[model samples]
Target: MLRELKILLLLIIVVGIIYWGVEPLAHSIMHPKVAPADYEFKDLDKIDLSKGDAQKGKKLVTENCTACHGIKAEKINPPMDNASSASSYGVVPPDLSNIAAVLDHNFLANFIKNPVKATELSHKFGDSNPYPMPGYDWMSDDEISDIVAYLASIASKNLSDKDVFTQACDRCHSIRYDKMVALTPDADLERYLGTKAPDLSMMIRSRGPKELSVFINNPQKMIPNTPMPRVGLTQQAEKQVISYLEKVGDSKKAQRDSLGIKIMIFFAVMALLAYAWKRKIWSDLH
Candidate 1:
């Protein structure tokens, strides 16, 4: 029994050491090889900004966007707590208020053209809508610009960071700022989103705007097998979301940084005093 017990202990230690030594390499090898990025802002540089008409955009918004989105705070999009919408899309559509501030015109225009192609996910996936956002490919360039303009006009200067969070990120992620932690469980997230979504609270601190923009534009290309779909937000919208994260995740960072200088000065003064006392005591001993 003693010999058997020793063998078991040795086996466990060996396994643990091997796992520790080989784990990182194993994970690297297992990681999916993402396809090269193909997603980009189509015709954004070529757009004639003079052609966009906000008034025309408003009319287009009424005809196309209002079905799943509402501009007012008092009104809710889709009019009911309908599971079918969530069943089809995996999340309820977000409100459009302040969208112009969060998303850039280029991404919004491309996304509006086609959500599926822009996000670059398999359209046949169970979570993706069977009849997704209709692409206005037939619309003239000016008309599409007008639609983007209308969406842009809805942004309000008075809107808070929380409002931006609600509009863009609340459906898939939940952050408990009061607790200073992320609340989503990996299992629940995988079930609902087909992969675990990271808590966004600290994301901006880790990833800057440029990298995030590419990731958000096409997640699959950035990290293969990642479950996050393209959010299809405009460039402005992405900025606002990042800004909001900075506020929530690193709200105290500025204050802490400022306080660090004072702390260092105090420590330096204390060290000098200690050195002086040590010299005085040694002088007496000598």
Candidate 2:
């Protein structure tokens, strides 16, 4: 009886070690640079946003941005249609109705000043290959601040999960399962990101939540040479984006989890019954 008990203890230890090595230990080796997501905009400092004026910003956007981009919340439409814009710029400019609410404030300010540098894609664009969005460096600091304030004032605070994902990711990455294709053309995305972005339809299930969160927060941390820049989404916006991805990628997660529990209970009961039978059959020998 003591020998049988010792054998069982050995099996448990072996199983535990296998699980540890296969899961956590292997994961640490694979993703050695894993880090927590950072939502702060610490890159470049510009004009003070507190003193900005929305009305002045609205005038500035109309005068400067409406030709290419649109502000749907303010009923501002792009002058060109989708196909024409794509042909001209290699990507369709997205609506900026909620950018200020979702994107980091300082990042937004710096992005308006220099799109390539703020996006960390200057290496991708060069003197001959200029970035599509012209920098508004000539605009005064106060003017840029006003534009940021105007965008903030018009942005909806309570956007849906889909809206958050659309604003934050859909431009580069497409969710084919949801029938949402990328706004940027594949060739253009490749030129900008070094490779075309992957479809997020099954990314949540493929990469898992923990990995996805850290990657989205800051891509360069995990992939040192990847051209995918930090999106700088607000925490709430990042959560909403991940939630949307989960909804699309793992819609039946709850049902799968419930079924898994039932399977575990069945296996556990079978194991107990088999052990009892083994002991009963060996009783005569003992």
Candidate 3:
């Protein structure tokens, strides 16, 4: 019995070693190193603004940008209705009309391309504005240069239509005009129009004024699956929102009229089919 007990104790020690050590080693081997690329610092000392194309930069802004930056380069375009209110992230979006006057072109370009690196350098070196600006690394070096050039063109007086929107609506929402405008494929335009958090882009493109009115009156009734709560609106306010959406949609590649017509046809066909089926079933029952 004593000999058997000694053998069991040895087995337990070996099992414990395998469980703690060998298991971890196996896991590490299974998940081989998957690290990010090594950081390479660019030398901004040789950048020449004379060679940059501001026109090309403007085109890039119109195509890949303008969602957050606004067409007029007025910092937060489509300014929030209220400037003093807290945002969803508890921070307010700042204005950018005078950014060129404040920051160097190279500094702006580098910061835009790699926000994390810019922040680290700022913290290590002495730079103003410690806020972490989000990166736009997807843009090529030439594109970044053009963006910087176009940004330099923004005057304090040349605010866009978004600025007008901000001045009107910033009272309640955390209106970060720049951030919202910068979002691509025009994602925020529908939310802005609906006054509720629904991807109304598809609906806006597919449905017309009449259909939108029905949904707006009682969105949950029309779309039970939708998370949008019906915010009671005056007829005038609803029209304004619709008009805004129509204009904004036209400016972008998204077309609402086409979508609205398709939705109408689909529902009409379904209704006719349902009526015929019901009539046939009733006759058979009789």
Candidate 4:
């Protein structure tokens, strides 16, 4: 019994040293500055949204946005087909019908004013390769506020996890595990974003949820000058998107954990039996 206790103590010390000390120190060295997720988007708080008039916004949106984006719920279609739009704009623009539901309000306003700056992709979308959306800084804040109101009023509610991920991420990244391809082809995305977006099928497993959330909220801070944009998803939508990624990447996690518990039980029983047999043989020898 004393010998068994000593061996157990040795095993515990080895595991504690590796798990509690070495692993954390290694992770800290590897990821020296992992920034926290910024769901609030505090920088874009200047606009006063209370002054918005949805009726006026409707007219403004019809005059401005319809030429490029389609609003399926409102029965508005883009003037050009996907191929034609891709040819003209370098990538097909996403529909505007659900934009308000997923995107943060403050971030949305800033994105409209200056997409390059808002997305933090000015490093790539500079003068050499112009960004597709022309800045709307000339529009009055009141007009922009009205547009935001109209968008919020029209947005669909209670979007599913898959729907949230589709709206927030599927436009740029592909999930090959789910058989979902990116909306924009790799060649066009390469030209538009400075590189093709990475396939996100295994990102959840690789990066884990905490890292994914922080990186998604602010890609620029995670990797300086990353071509990937700060998507500006609302907190709820961000959670939904990450949930869907976990569903796709770790679908069998529950089953795997259950099996692991069973395996541990089997090992414990075998260890007890082995110890009992050794004690029986040693009793006769002593």
Highest-scoring model, TM-score: 4
Worst window of 10 by summed lDDT in candidate 4: 38-47
- Candidate 1 residues 1-286, lDDT tens each? 4776799899999998789878767855765445433334552334454578989888887887887666663253654343554554455565676666655566667667655555555543435444345666777778879988877766776656666666666766766663333223445445656666667777767865556656766677667656577765655555666677778778887899889999999999998899799779979999
List the RMSD of every prediction in angstroms.
Answer: 10.8, 2.3, 24.6, 2.0
TM for every model, in the order presented, reads 0.64, 0.89, 0.32, 0.91
Model 1 residue 137 CA deviation (Å) reads 2.3
lDDT of 3 by residue, 1-286 (tens): 4776799899999999999999989966864433221122233323445656778876776665544333334434643422222232123333445444334466567766765454333332225433323568887777888877876776344434444333222322332322332221123423322233333334446776656655554454455535333333334445554555455544453555678889999999998899799779979988
- The lDDT, on a scale of 0 to 1, for candidate 2 is 0.84
Best by lDDT: 4
**Compared with the true structure, what per-residue lDDT tens digits does model 4 show for residues 1-286?**
7988999999999999999999999988987666578888876656888888989999999999998999987999888886677667877788888899999887898888889888888788878887898888999999999999999889899789998888788768899999998887778777767787899988889988888888889988778988888889988898898899889998887799999999999999999999899999999999
Any idea what lDDT model 1 has? Answer: 0.65
Q: Write the per-residue lDDT of candidate 2 for residues 1-286, one digit (tens) a residue.
A: 8998899999999999889767788878887956577666556665588889999999999899988898889887878876677768866787899999889887888889888777777666779988789999998888999999999999998899999999888878899999999888787767655577898899999888888888887777777757776677878888888899989999999899999999999999999999899989999778
Cα lDDT computed for each candidate against the true fold: 0.65, 0.84, 0.49, 0.87
Runs in model 1 with CA error above 4 Å?
1-45, 73-82, 120-131, 178-192, 199-225, 229-243, 246-251
Can you tell me which runs of candidate 2 are displaced by over 4 Å?
21-25, 191-194, 284-286
Q: In candidate 4, which residue pairs get closer than 3 Å at backbone N, Cα or C atoms, i.e. clash?
A: none
